[model samples]
Each structure stands twice: as structure tokens, then as C-alpha cells.
Target: MTPERFAECLASLRWTAIDLTSALQCQLSWIEAMEGGQAEIPEDLARWLESLAKCHEAAGIPSHYRGVAQF
Candidate 1:
């Protein structure tokens, strides 16, 4: 996914760069760079986001709020 998409997805999931860093076990700087459009969204990170979306779906946690993901 593009950096912009990654940022959007993150907003949808109600996650901050700090949260993603913890979840992905990556450096906060990495997440910051990705979200700030200084770096590309890695393939693995995109896949992980997709998996998180699926988990949210399975848990019956609404994925969006007003056309944006809220969880």
C-alpha cells in the first residue's frame, strides 16, 4: 500500500504511530516515517494491517465510523 493509504488505514483503526510500533515491534521512527510520507509502506506492514482489519471484522468491531474505520 502507499504511504497515504497506510496513514488512512491507521486513522481508521484508531491507531497512532506509537501503537503500530508496539504492535509490529518496529521502531517508532520507522512508523513515523511511513505515516509522515517519508518512506514507503512495506509489503509486510500492509499485510499486517489487512490481517488486523480481518480480526476486527471477525470480532464484530465495526471497521469504520462515518466512512472511516473507527477500530
Candidate 2:
């Protein structure tokens, strides 16, 4: 994903790594790697993040708060 877009997602999520990891059902290290752009975001992780964002939106979060995803 474009770095800017990734940053946007992070911002929307309020930098809550623990919460995001729980939402994505992944380890915090995984989320940290992806957010820090240290590890290449695999397709699965990308999909996971997308699904998590959708879930958040469905739970009454604003759609506009969601960000574009990339692998």
C-alpha cells in the first residue's frame, strides 16, 4: 500500500496496536512490522486488515475512518 494510505489507516485506528492486533487476530509484532513497514505486508495480512476495518465499520465506526489497504 502507499505509505500515505497506510499511515492514514494507522491514524484512523488511533495508533492502538493492541486493539488492532486483537481486531485482526494477529500478534502485535506482526502489526508492528506491517505498520513500521519493516516487513512486507503479505496478502493474507492485507486481507486481514481489510476485514478488520470492515468489521470496525459494521460495529458503528464511520466508514470514512477506514483507509485503503495494500500488500
Candidate 3:
């Protein structure tokens, strides 16, 4: 996904970069790279986020993760 679309996805999901890094159990730098267009967003991740966004819109997923500390 392009950086713009990736950002849009995050907004749709009500996720900040920190929230996403926490949700995905990934490093913030990786999220940054993806957001900054320095790294190609893996297709699996793009697809995953797309599906997750749909779920989010339906309120199928929790608004935030429980028991996960925010950095």
C-alpha cells in the first residue's frame, strides 16, 4: 500500500502509530518506515489492515488492546 493509503487505514482504525506498533507487536521504526514511504508495506500487512479496518468499522474488534502498555 502507498503511504497515503496506509495512513488512511490507520485513521479509519482509530490508531496512532504507537497504537499500531503495539497492536501488531512491531517496532515503531518499522511503522515509521512504512509511513514515511521508506519501506514497502508488505502485502500481507496491507491486506490484514484492510480487513481489520472493516472489522473495526463494524465494531467487531475492541477499540484498543487490553493489558498492553502504551509506549
Candidate 4:
């Protein structure tokens, strides 16, 4: 996925960079690189994020707020 799409997924999940770093057990710089287009978001990782967003959607996490997703 593109860096912009990665960032959008993060926003949809209401996750900050720190939250992603903790969850992925990776360095903040690595995530920053991904978000900044210095690194590519892996295909598996991209698919996982998409699935997570789907889960959140299916569970009505964002249903109350329309396009806005809440953690």
C-alpha cells in the first residue's frame, strides 16, 4: 500500500504511531519511514490492516460515526 493509504488505515483505526510501534514491536523510525514513503508497507501487513478495518467495521466500531472510526 502507499504511504498515504497506510496513514489513512492508521487514522481509521484511531491508532497513533506509538500504538502501531507497540503492536508491531518495531522501531518508531521504521513506522515513520513507512508513513513517509521511505519504506514500503508489506503486502501481508497491508492485507492484515485491511482485515482489521473490516473487523472494526463489522463490529460497528465506526457505525456510529459514519466515516470516523474510534478506537
- Pick by TM-score: which candidate is best? 4
Alpha-carbon error at 64 in model 4, in Å? 7.7
Q: Write the per-residue lDDT of candidate 2 for residues 1-71, one digit (tens) a residue.
A: 64455556656556577877787688989777767878777777566556755665567655774685855
Clashing pairs in 2: none
Task: Summarize candidate 3's per-residue lDDT along 1-71 as a digit string, tens digits.
Answer: 89998998899888999999998899999999999999999999999998988777777556569888989
The candidates, ranked best first by TM-score, are 4, 3, 1, 2
After TM-score superposition, what is the CA distance of residue 65 in candidate 2 from its true location, in Å? 18
Q: 2 or 4: which has the higher lDDT?
A: 4
Kindly report which residue pairs in candidate 4 clash with one another. none
The whole-model C-alpha lDDT of candidate 3 against the native structure comes to: 0.91
Each prediction's Cα RMSD?
6.8, 10.6, 7.6, 5.6
Task: Kindly list the per-residue Cα lDDT of model 4 for residues 1-71, writing each as its tens digit.
Answer: 89998888888788988999999999999999999999989999899888886676667553456768668
Please report how far candidate 2 places residue 26 from its true position, in Å.
1.2
Off by over 4 Å in 4: 62-71
Compared with the true structure, model 4 gives a TM-score of 0.77
Query: What is candidate 2's CA lDDT for residue 38?
Result: 84
Candidate 1 local lDDT, 1-71, one digit each (tens)? 87877876776677888888898898999888887888888788798887776675567654555587567
Highest lDDT: give the candidate number.
3
Residue 68, candidate 1: how far off, in angstroms?
A: 24
lDDT agreement with native, every candidate: 0.79, 0.67, 0.91, 0.86
